[model samples]
Target: MSRDGTSASRNAPLVGTLLVLGYCVINSTKSVFEGSLVQHLSPEFIAFNSFVLAQGFYFMICRDKAALLATVRRCLPDVIALNVATMVSWVAVLYAFTVFEPAMANSVILGLVPSITIALGFKLRPGVRALRLEVVAALGMLAAMSFLVAAAWNGSSAIGDLPKDDLAAGLIYCVLTSFALSAITYFTRRLGDQGMSVQQMMASRFGVLILVTLGLLIGRDSFDAYTPRNIGAILLISIVGVIVSLYLLQAGMVRTEPITVSMLFGTNLIITYVVQFLDPRLHQSTTTFVGVLVLSAAMCLGAWARWRDGRDNPPAGVPDKVPAEVPAEAEGTTQNVGNRT
Candidate 1:
């Protein structure tokens, strides 16, 4: 790692953009499936089935068992924490969906991810400090998120309004989801520091979630409620959302700062709104339009931060300690985690 405590690859900006875009798309699609599937299935069942299926997919493609074993051994605590955090985030989000509007839930919870990730990164790796420009960018991003949520509440009633009965539970679950996701981001970076590949992390995480699911299923009648449609939805979500989305996330986080990665995920709100706008049946109010403008300005600030990083070699005052040329995959002996498939 550099003196700045970042393991960022040379192509971090390019790779991170692609990874975030792909993740946003997958998450948007997953919301669709969850909307349909959650009606007939319990959150535990959906989570369990998705992880089990995703683990199976990983097993079918995973190679370098010895290296994987070593990585797991070296990072057992991080791995366990990652798994626990991941499950909690998903379960909370699933339940939040039941009690709140999709936009409302994401607006409240997802904004916390980037801020919490920055705090966690600083705590875990003492040398990691946000550049002044990056701090400004992060605050802009948060402001944009607040604008979007306020828009949801004030305008486009269909996009943001929630029932009074479910408000307390929804807020609680959203808070849980946010904190858990932040923890997941921290552990992901820790695991990356231990030289674990994306595939290895995915395999270990889903494998652990599966085990937890089985433990929850003990003496329960949960499996009896499965239907072919819901089962198909689970398979789709497992493949696209769990397997593909997380793989991109793990791969990207290895080459990017965890806080930056989480910040990039904030784009999911824009993506979700865009998806809704494309649907002919829905109509957004004037407030949504103004919110989009504010969010776009936030994105411009974020883009400026990335541009500043790329153009200013020494980052204004910091000494040039990072290697001029480092192999992107030098973190571990098992180089290409994505190669097996």
Candidate 2:
């Protein structure tokens, strides 16, 4: 290779790391913004606008129309399944944000995603072996989530004066988000195995939600909600959170190791908590502090376990082993765990 080529190759990982970190920070901040927007705009309206804008952006930038169309036609069922999963996840997480603090909602959804994905992976693919460390890490995350739920139930959460009923509903929505995301990850992987690129998958994944959300908007005549301010907010989030964030993630995944990507993405929790703390509108309690700490630890442990597994069982002909639980791209929302919305 030329000297310049060698230099560029050497710096690729660093560049990729920076891009992924940028994605983490941007998505985390967008989650807080979504929470605030939900106070004025219904989750369905926000979701509808986000999907429509993202679809437009993806369609315009997509370079391989022939390849994308071939893949969609060949794997039509899987494509539909992935779109359905994305729709459910986007709606659930957005609704969850309406009731829960953005930080708390992000923490629960991102923190529990790996565990949920792992469990579902095992159930769907019985022959795959589960790592002992990964199992322990999953249990730790569950326990931490349980503690956070208990805190919310007793009204001792960092978000002050949350009604128990609303909090409970929010938590349920978070769980639903996790499940939908797991399904999204699964279907994304399946389509990948069938030769679909991340860009193609993204281009195809929003169609179902676009139709569903558009129908709801038309039925309710929610176009009145599209004031200048709301349009600006939705466009900002769709551009930064959905389009640019997922682009960064896809680019980073190509150059960086999966373990690095997992760890960097895990930092979203801290970034989110700090942003929430700075926002005067949000509240933080002692339990919230402890919960963040616990969730962070759980995330690190899970990342480490995945790293160790890759080390012990390196895939043949592959230089970097992809983390099994981290999805390569996020759709719709700004916070989709590994992909982050």
Candidate 3:
């Protein structure tokens, strides 16, 4: 290789790491934005509008319309499953945000996603096994969640007092969010394994969700919620949260190791807490802060575990070049729309 080419190859991982970091920072703010939007616009309206905007964006940038249609047709069942899972997860998290403080909701609820995904993976894939460190990390994150729970129970939450019934309901919604997100992740990986590109998946994943949210808006008579300000907010979030962040993640994962991507994403908890701290409407209690720290650590540990496993079991040989038909799963990039929160 030429010297410049060699230099570029060496720097690719660094560039990818920076891109993923940018994604983490951008994605971390999603909950805060959605929380604010939900207070003015119904969750259904926000969801409906966001999905519509995102769908348009994806369609514009989609490179191979024919390939996307063919993939959807070939994997019609999986596409439907993915859409249902994304809808449930999206709506559940939005409802949870309405009940819990945005940052707190992110920490206490969305924080459980990795662990839940692990559990789901174990159950769904019989031959798969989790690393010891992953199990420990999952348990640690669960334990850390208790501190936030305790704060809420004692009426000492950082976001101010929440009603007990609402808190209970929010917890239930959180559970639903976690499970649905895990399912979405699982379906995303399965589709990737079956030859769907990330763009193809994103382009087709929201059909059911759009229909459901539209029905909800009609039933609630929420057309009035689409004021100029609300519309602007939806557009901004769709551009920043859905389109830009996913693009960065996809580009970064293509060049970086999966472990590095995982580790960078783990920092999202801290970034989210910091964003919440800056927002005048939200506050972080000491216990909740500590819990966030622990959860972040747990996430890092889990990433390390996965990395170690891969290292210990390297592929038998490196290919000179990737096969043309290899899917995104083989390339170490998978769609994860759940981060849009």
* Model 1 alpha-carbon drift over 4 Å, by segment: 1-23, 144-156, 159-161, 214-224, 246-267, 277-300, 314-341
Candidates in order have lDDT scores of: 0.60, 0.75, 0.75
Per-residue lDDT over 1-341 for candidate 2, one digit per residue giving the tens place of the 0 to 100 score: 99999999999899989998998898888888888888878777888888888998787777989988987999999999988888888888888988888777876876677677777766754555556776676777777778777777777766666777898799899988888887886787678777777667777789988888888778877654567888889889888888888877777776787677777877787787777776677777778668877877776776777667767877689745354323454311112345544
Write one digit per residue (lDDT tens) for candidate 1, span 256-315: 543354446555555665665553434555565455445445544554565455466545
Return the lDDT, model 3, position 175.
82
Flag regions of model 3 displaced more than 4 Å. 317-341
C-alpha lDDT of residue 263 in model 3: 70
> Lowest-lDDT window of 10 residues in candidate 2?
327-336
Ten-residue region with minimum lDDT total, candidate 1: 332-341
**lDDT score at residue 296, model 2, on the 0-100 scale:** 71
Write out the backbone clash pairs for model 1: none
Q: What is the full ranking by lDDT, best candidate first?
A: 2, 3, 1
| Candidate 1 accuracy as TM-score | 0.72
Runs with alpha carbons beyond 4 Å of true place in candidate 2: 219-223, 319-337
Candidate 2 TM-score, C-alpha based: 0.91
